[model samples]
Target: MKKKVFCVLIYLQFCFIFPKTSFPGFRAWLSPYRMALGGSGYLSFSPLTNRNNPASLKSKKTFYSGLIRYPSSIMGQGLAITLPKKERVVGLAVQHLSYGTFDGYDSESISTEKYSSSDTWINFYSSKRSTWDDLKYGFAISWFKSSLAQNQINAIVFSLGLQLYLKSIDANLGISLNNHGKVFSNSSNSSGEMPKETVISSSKKLKYLPMKIFFDGIFNSRYKLDNINFGGEAKINNDLEFVWGTSLNKISQNTRQSFWKSFFAASGIGLAYNINSIKIFYSSFFLGTGTLYNGVSFEINVI
Candidate 1:
């Protein structure tokens, strides 16, 4: 079966990716939904949500989303395809962030073209509904690769997530355990364990208002209290929405920084259009300064 083959692939990855050491500031890539919602994605409706909470793969459609950074070469793209039974989903996602190319010199102070320092992630996800309470269970395997000069570092991480929806309260809760694995290096002297983290998030739809509020709390084993983010989305109509939120994670003590920088307030607007069985969405967010992160996605409800 396809599931058996995928399981074998995951087993092979664990064998090659788990030999262990320690490093801080591991790759914390964010999806567009996370960026637009000020870093809250545990209960987002985008295809990329699988990266944040695999239990969010409850969609019964063929979904795709892609994001590109402004004035940069960074990109994140993902796709989700639902099974015929409509109770399970499988997905794949890829993200690449480049820190630009640098000059390679032989200690002669002479330019030798440019080599890029980049990080990439290739992830696979699957989720299914449990027999009780309609709850969802999800799993993900991530392949992390970092390229710096001639050295390439690779690692694999496993994640488990669960999602529950309370219709009486109009609220959804998602919990995830992430980054469980070890690192491997092609060069000598640099192999370590990845930073493990726990994420808890919830979203509540207000009864009186056309809005939904989201909250997320993350705990890192190596770096306690990593961040707390919350935001709200106000629906103006069935197709247009406004979003705003702030991140309290990386605030600075400097008083001279812009207010946006001081609190990391990220705001954005989104529009969606539905045509028969297909729906398209577009969204963009402020990333401080003049840079903006943009995202677009489409979904097809298959018959």
Candidate 2:
């Protein structure tokens, strides 16, 4: 479909341009911005994965998510909101992506523009249940604008979910406990100095499985050290309406790299289109590094 939307618009312009000076030393987890905030495969996007598994939040009565992103040549917009909570089940999301007049001169000597950049992401989710047939366990917190500066990155996640049925077969499982507030903060560079190195990153999500066919994994570490990540994904169908997939991500041997992301292996392909109100979610059928992503998430149900 137009080359999976031009390989995720060239993967957001080759990794959303980063440089506020200090692009040296810190090869702990080769992060292409944590694999572009991950999500190229594995279950091919599950209601926007936080993994407290609500079974794709069950048919949705109201869930709004929109995006106009091209994080690389700069032009962005994002939004999200999923709700239905009294026993507590809510999701609020915000994404502003970024903007900047990109320094202008390739550096022959800039006269007016000093430099500037941006990053954003905000997410919140809640779930509570002790006795409710829907059986769920939830936790998610995100505020990551911290690539190094606009520092907002604070994360706390813990989730456990399960759903099972027999008649038509429906299964779900989710496990979490990621970034648990090991939040690192130490930024000051609007000219206040004091920040030689205070980088922080953490990860965990060994698996999230929703059956009919799909699985996901993550465990790239860094907070206290000792890391490992081995991924997985699988999907196949042709009747309930054709869809295919494959995925694999590996990083072990103390998993780490961060001079601009390393570690290999990638796979893709899982597209869905249900015409009417129009629905289109895509994939680039195996994209490892140059580009991949053309996410068109749509949902609107009023009942």
Candidate 3:
């Protein structure tokens, strides 16, 4: 019954929160643009092997923070870093959620009160790939904050992913186990003592069925001296995707809107360029009222 409800909520969201022309709500609003454009992207997530499922993790340009995302009204930043390596590849990333401030609504009056304090939920994660065999693994631990009510929800997440690589065409099949929602706290009153010290608690914690499995593939080609990357993937159930991206291209603005605005408002093209050891690109997400995210990253040789 709960699963049925969750599905209906997502369907209803499409009608209101996410119209055919726009998507600007909650998690969708805060999501980084690059991944968003990649088909409600879970496969493009760094440190997690589930969605960031490019089979080219062994290439020369493999270990670099290929994305930096900043959303308007969002209090935190998301970082993706790839460690330098020749044989053994390591990837690390941290997504800081909530710089602070969330409004709590009073059930009686239905009035919202913004909390003066909030906790930072960060995903500390890493991945490893080497000449070991066909098995590629990745994992991470996450600290979470309140997903709903008055500081009543908080918990930790333990995640693991396994990738099975196919020899032909360089394709990959992967599965991941994740704890989607868990809450932990002390004092059922919503103002309890620390979780470790008290017997009574107000928070929630992870329980059951928090798992996801996905498959993805990527193809690289060169056109007119420029590089073209074609990639797509699907995550478990309830998510779908299809996208087109190219490098070394620009469009002329023939209107009053700014070049960037007009370029993106009309489903503009993205630019990805590699400079020596660093990879750079202009990525943005059109979610929310529309935010422009600017990002930069460098590959560091660390073991």
What alpha-carbon RMSD in Å does predicted model 3 have with respect to the real structure?
Answer: 15.5
Give the Å shift of residue 263 in candidate 2: 21
Worst 10 residues of 3 by lDDT: 196-205
The CA lDDT at 154 in model 2 is: 32
lDDT of 3: 0.37
Local distance difference test, each candidate: 0.63, 0.37, 0.37
- What lDDT is reached at residue 248 by model 1? 56
Output the number of the lDDT-best candidate: 1
Error of 1 at 123 (Å): 1.4
Clashing pairs in 2: 7-292, 12-72, 28-257, 29-256, 29-257, 30-257, 30-258, 30-261
lDDT of 3 by residue, 1-303 (tens): 343344334334433432321111112222233432332223345442222332223323344343333332333344555553555444554544332344455768575765532233455455556476776666656665543234344567555555666666344455444433345653334532211100000111113422222222322111112112222222223322223222111122123356555444313123344454443444443322233444433343333
User: What does the lDDT read for residue 116 in candidate 1?
Assistant: 59
Residue 214 displacement (Å), model 3: 11
What is candidate 3's TM-score against the reference?
Answer: 0.47
Clashes of 1: 1
